[model samples]
Target: MDILLSICAFILAILGIAGCIVPVLPGTLLSYGGLLCSYFASYSQMSTSALWIWLAVCIAVSLADYFLPAWMTRRFGGSRAGSIGATIGIFVGFFAGPVGIILGPFVGAVIGELVNDRSDFAKALVVGFGSFLSFFVGTGIKLIVAVGILVHVVADIWVHVVADIWPAFWNWLTNLF
Candidate 1:
């Protein structure tokens, strides 16, 4: 049962990493969930304070994820419409794969800008560039945080298993390879 929980948690961690790029999944949160699972499996071994800290970070990052793109849009002189369009584009881009994910926000921003002001193509382009940059930046941030959480979880699990069950750890490692 313990091994099964660990396996499921590891899978969730991998999914969280994938989610960072994919956008449809709550990458950081899901990754954190994996840690939570691992914690449950070894409740007495895991540090409660450490878990709380991770949860706090995850929540903060998730909240920031929502605002960064829009904030970035406005920072680059994009109108509210452009921000909204970029948000929508993120959802649409999910269906189209990586290239589409990169382009969707940019194109959407441009279109939104154009719709807002037909006379300023140059400004629209600028806003589109801002939106594009923001998307990539946001994705990078999510990837970093999710991976960090996954690493922490893995390390925590490693400490528990290696310290408490060294023989089992060595046996498992040998078998895994």
Candidate 2:
């Protein structure tokens, strides 16, 4: 049961990291789930304080991922249309691979701004840049959190499982020789 939980935790942590870039999954939340799994595992040495702290960080990062781009678009003088377009572009861009993921927000914001008001291409570009910048910031934060959780899980597993097994395995190997 402990091994199963640890495996689940590891898988969730990995998915969380991927989710940070994919935009479709809840990256930090998934990481939090991983942390929870570890906490419940008998072999985990994760403290309660650590769990609470990670929970808060996960929620904050998740919320930020949703709102940051729109907030940035507005900050850069973009309208609601630009924000909406950027959100839509994320889903559409997912099908186009990495390049699309990187450019989707900017292009979407620009297109939306142009559609909303064709009089200012320059403004549209600025708004697009803002969305692009937000994507990087949000992804960075999510990645950091996800990776941190993954590391924590891995460390716990190593300490509780591998460290215990290594000595016995070494002895067995020596005996065989």
Q: Identify the leading candidate in terms of lDDT.
A: 2
Candidate 2's C-alpha runs over 4 A off are 165-177
Residue 26's lDDT within candidate 1 is: 89
Question: Which residue segments of model 1 deviate by more than 4 Å?
Answer: 159-177
What do the candidate models score in CA lDDT, each in turn? 0.82, 0.87
**Per-residue lDDT for 163 in model 2?**
65
lDDT of 1: 0.82
Candidate 2 on 20-116: residue-level lDDT in tens? 9886788888888888888899877889999999998998998888888888988999999999888877777778889898888888889989999
TM-score (all chains, Cα) for each model? 0.86, 0.87
Task: Indicate the worst ten consecutive residues by lDDT in candidate 2.
Answer: 160-169
Task: Output candidate 2 Cα RMSD.
Answer: 3.1
Which tens-of-lDDT digit does each residue in 48-126 have in candidate 1?
8988998898888888887876777788999999898777777787788888888888888888888899899999899
